[model samples]
Target: MSLHEQLYQWTASQGLDATSARRLRALSGVDDPPGDPWTPLRRGAGALAAGLIGFGLILWVAANWDDFGRAMRFGLLQAALAISLIAAAALRPWRAPLALAAFLTLGGLLAFFGQTYQTGADPWQLFALWAALGLPIAWASRSDLAWTPWALVVATGIGLWMETFGGHSWRFDASTVPVHAIGFVAYGLLCAGLALRPGAASQPWAWRLAVLASVIAISGTALGGLIARDVAPQFYLGLGVMGVGLVLAWRHSEVYAMSALALSVDTLLVVGLARWMSKERLDVGGYFLIALVACGLLAGSVTLILGRLRDAEARA
Candidate 1:
C-alpha cells in the first residue's frame, strides 16, 4: 500500500482525530534515528570471541594438565601469555580484548605455578599478585573490561585475606564481623575515589564494581549481626560506612550510588526489625499486625524512592 494510505488506515483503525493523525504523520516523516547501533554489537561480539578463546585455552590446559611435565606446562602457559600480549599489541582497535586475555592468562599461569611448586603461600597472596601484575595492563588499555577484572582480583584478594585472619569461611559471623566492616569501608572509599578522581573519568567499571562490593560487604555484615544477635561494634562501623556512602551519593546525584544507599538502608531497617522480633513474644494477632506494618513501611518507602528517582531523571 502507499505510505499515505497506510497512515490513513492506521489512524482510522485507532479512531484518532484529524489533529492527532496529522501530528503522528509529521513525527513519522522526520529523519530516522541517528547513529550506527551496530558499532556496539560488533565490539561486543569481538570481546565475546576473545573471552571464548581465553576460556578455551584454560580448558585445554585443564584437560591435558596431568599429561604434561612441569617444564612443558610452564612453557605452554608462558607461550600463551606471550602470544596474547603480542596479539594485543598488533590488534590495534581490538587491543582491549587481547590485553584482557593476556591479563587473565597470567592468572592461570600463577595458579598453575602455585599448584606445581606446592607453594605454602596463602590464597590471598596469589590474588594480590594477580591484581598487582594486571594493574599495568589495565592502565595501558584504559578499557572498562580491563578495570572490571582488576576490581574483581582486588576484591578476591581482600576477601581471602579477611577469611584467613578472621577465622571464618565465606559467610559472616562474630569472628568475621570486623573483617566485613573493614571490607565495606575500604571498598566504599575505593568507590568514592573512583567516582571523584580526576584520572578515573574513563573508567566507569571502577565505581560500579566498587559500589557493588561495598554493598555486599555492608549487607553481609549487617545481616550476620542480626543472625548472631551480637550487634558488635563492627556492625556499627558498617552502618557508619553506609551513611557516608549515602551522603556522598546524594551530593553527587548519581543513580547507582543512590540505589546502593537505599538498599543498604533498607537492609539495616530489616535487620533491626528482625532483632526486635527476636526479643518479643507475640501472639498470632500481634505477629500479623507486625507483618502488616512492615509491609506498609516497605511499600511506602519504595514508592517514595521511586518518585525521587523520577524527579532526578527529569532534572537530568
Candidate 2:
C-alpha cells in the first residue's frame, strides 16, 4: 500500500475521533487536493505562443527591410524589447512567456546591430555578450524555458571562442590532439558544473543538456585517439569517462547520468575488438569466438545498467 493509505489506516485503527483523524490525514497530506491536469497544457501553450510571436517578429522585420529607414528599424526593435519587458513585469506570476519573448527580441536586436554596423568583432564575442545580457531576464523569470536556450547560446559562444581565439584547430592529428583533448576536458568540466548547479533539479533539461555536452566532449577526445591509432589514450579516456559516470550515478542517482558509462563501455568493447583483430591477427574462427564473447559481455553490462537506470528513474 502507498504511504498515505498506510497512514490513514493507522490513524483510524487508533480509535481517534473523526475530526482528529481528518486533521491527521490532512496534515500528513493523505487528504491533499487533486492536481490540476491543465497546468502542463497551459505552460506548453504559453511557450508555443512565445515562439510564434518571436518568429513572426523576425519575419516581419525581414519583409520590411528595404522600406524601413535605419532609425525606424532600431526604434521598432527597441520598442518591442521595452514592451516585452513591461509585459513580463505586469504579468508577475505568469511572466515566462513575456520573459522568453524579451530574450528572443534581444537576440534579434543584436543580430540587427551586427548586420548594420559591421563591428569587426569575433562571432563568439557577440554571442557571449548576448548571453551575458540575457542572464537577468532568465534569472528573474526563474523558468527553464528561459534558461535552457540561454545556456545553449552561452555554450555555443564559449565553444566558438575557444576554437578561434584559444589557438586551436579541428584537426585530429598528433599536433592538435593534446590541445583538443585539453579543450574537451575544460568544456566538459564547465558542462558538469552546470549540471550540478543548485536549483538544476527543477530544470532537468539544463542538467540533461549539460550531461550530453560533457559526454560528447569526452567522446570526441576518445574518438580522436582511436583515429590516431593510439590505443593507450583511447583506452584511458574511455575509462575516465566511465569512472565519472559511475560517480554521478552513485552519488546523484540520476537516470540520464549513466549515459556516459554505457557509451564508454561500448567504446571499450569496440576498441578491444579492433586491437585484437589488428595486433593478434587471429584466425577467422578465433575472431568469431572473441566477437561472440564480447557481445555477450556488452549485453550483460547493458542489462545491468538498464536495471539501475529504471531504479534511478523511480527514485527521481
Candidate 3:
C-alpha cells in the first residue's frame, strides 16, 4: 500500500480526532494533497499541438511542392525552424513541446537540403547528423518529449548503417557475428547510459525505447541464428544480455522491461523448438506440442512476474 494509505489506516486505528489527524498528516507530509490535475492535460495539449503543427507543415510542403519555388520551400522550412527555436527559448513553460517542434523542423530542413542539393550522402548520414544536431535541443528541453524521438532517430541511423554498410550480407552466420555483437553492445551501452542518468527513474521513456530497441535487435539476430542452425557468437551474447537485463529489471521491480525481456526469450525458445521439430520431420503432433509449450512458457512468465511484484510489495 501507499504511504498515504498506511497513514490513513494508522489514524483510523488510533481513533484520532480531526485536528490530531491533520496534525499527524502535516507532520508526516505523507498525506499531502494532489497538485493541479490540469497541468498534465495542458502539457498533453501542447505536445499534441506541436505534433499537429509539424505534420501540417509537412503536408503543406508536400501538397504545394510543384507550385512553390525552390527558394520558397527552403525559406518556409527555415522560417518554421527558426520560429520553433525562438519559441522554445522564450517560453519556459512550453519549452518541451517547442523544442520537439524545433527538432522535427530541423530534420525536415536537413532532408530538404540533402534532396535539393543532392549531397551524395547515405540515408544513415542524414539521420546521424540530425540526431547529433538535435542533441542540444533535447538536453535543453530536459524532457522525454525530445529525448524519446532523439532515441528513435539514433536507433534508425544505427539500423540503416547496419543494413547498408555493416558488410553482414543480411545473414546470421559467423561472418556477421561480430557486427551483430557490436550493434547489441552499442544498444546496451545506450540503454545503460540513459538508465544511469540522474533522475532517470522519473524520465523513463528514452531508456525504455533504448531497451525495447536492443531487445528487438538481439531477438531478431538470435532467432535468425537458431533458424539457420549456425548458433553464432552473437546468439550467446544476446542470451547473456537478455539474462542480465532480466536480472536487473527484476531487482529494480521494472515490470515493463521484465515483461519485454521475458517475452523475447519465450519467442526465441518457441522458434527454436519449431526449428528442431522441422529438422526432425516430426508429425502434426509436434505442432500441438509446440503450442502447449508456448502456452506453458507464457503462463510461467506471468506467474513469475506477478510473484515478483507481490514479493516486492510485501517487502515494501
Candidate 4:
C-alpha cells in the first residue's frame, strides 16, 4: 500500500474515524453519559442542609422544653424526632424502608406515650396526635417501608398508653375498653397488612412482625388487665414473654432497640405493680427462670441471623 493510504488505515484503527467520532459527539448533544460529574457535591450539600435543619429544630425544642409539661415536652420531642428522621429518610440515597421504619417506630413509641408523661394532656390528646401524625405519615410518602412498622408501633403504643391511663378497669362496660380495642385491632391490622405486603418488613423480621401480631392476638386478656389489673398476675408473665420475643426478633430493628423495655415494663407491672395492689402473692420463680433462659437463647439467635441477613442485603 502507499504510505499515505497506510497512514489513513492506521487512523481508522485508532477509533478516531471521523464518522464514529461525529456520532459520539451527536449522542452527547442529547444524553449526558451515565452520571453527573457534580452529583456528589450536591448530595453532600443536601445532607448538610438536612442535618442543620434537624439540629436547629432540636435546639429550639430544648430551649422551649421547660415551657411545656414533662409529657408535652417529650411529645413535642417525639413529633420532631419522627419528622426529622422521616426527612432524613426521604433524602437517603437508598433503602427508604429503613427510614420509614425509623419514622414509624419512633413516631409510634414517642407520640403514644408522650401523653402519659405529660401532666395535663388528656387521654384523647395522644389519640389526636396519632390521628394527626398517622394521617400525614400514611399520606405524605408512598413508602410502606417506614410507615408500616411506624403504624404498628404507634398502634400498639397507643393501645397500651390508653390502657395505662384507663387504669386496668376491665369493666368491659366502660367506654375505654371498646375504644381501645377497636383502635388496637385497627393498628394491629395495619401492621400486619404492612408486614404482609412486599418490601416492608423483609425476612427474619418479617417473621418477627408476624410474631408481634400473634402476640397481640393472644394478649387479649392481658390487654384488659393493663387497664384494671383484673386477671391473674400470670398475665404479666405472658406479656413479658411476648415482649422478650418481640425484642429478640425486632429489637435490632430499632435505633434505641428497646425490645427489652417492653419486657421490663410488662414484667415489672406483672410482678411488681400487681404485687403492690393487695395480697402480694409472688411465686413462679422456677417457671420464669426457665422461660428467661429459653427466651434469651431465642433472642440471641434471631439477632445473629438478622444481622447476617441485613449484611447480605447490603452486599446484594
- Which number leads on TM-score? 3
RMSD of each: 5.7, 6.4, 4.8, 16.3
Against the unseen true structure, what C-alpha lDDT does each candidate score? 0.75, 0.72, 0.85, 0.50
Error of 2 at 24 (Å): 23
Write down the lDDT that model 2 would get: 0.72
Instruction: Put down candidate 2 lDDT per residue, 1-316, tens digits, no spaces.
Output: 9977787688778988888777667666656787888977777889999999889988998999899999999999999999999999999755988898998899889988998999988888888889889989887887777877777777677567646643545444445545555555655665676666557667778656656665665565566556564554644654566676767675665556665556565666676666656776678887787778778877876787778766765454
Tens-digit per-residue lDDT, 1-316, candidate 4: 8645555565577757788655544543433456665765654554355446546655786688668786686666566656656554565553343344334444446454664556565455555565456545444444443444545455555555555655644333344545445544554455455555545543324334534554554365454455454554434544655565455435344422234334444444444444444454446864565457556655765575567556644453
Order the candidates by lDDT, highest first: 3, 1, 2, 4
TM-score of each: 0.79, 0.74, 0.84, 0.36
**Top lDDT hit:** 3
- lDDT at 268 for candidate 4? 42
Residue runs of model 4 more than 4 Å from their true location after superposition? 1-52, 60-124, 131-133, 138-140, 144-149, 168-184, 196-198, 201-316
lDDT score at residue 67, model 1, on the 0-100 scale: 97
Candidate 1: clashing pairs of residues: none
Q: Given candidate 3, what's the lDDT at residue 56?
A: 93
Q: How high a TM-score does candidate 3 get?
A: 0.84
Error of 2 at 258 (Å): 0.8
In candidate 1, stretches whose alpha carbon ends up further than 4 angstroms from where it belongs are: 1-35, 168-181, 196-203, 300-304, 307-316
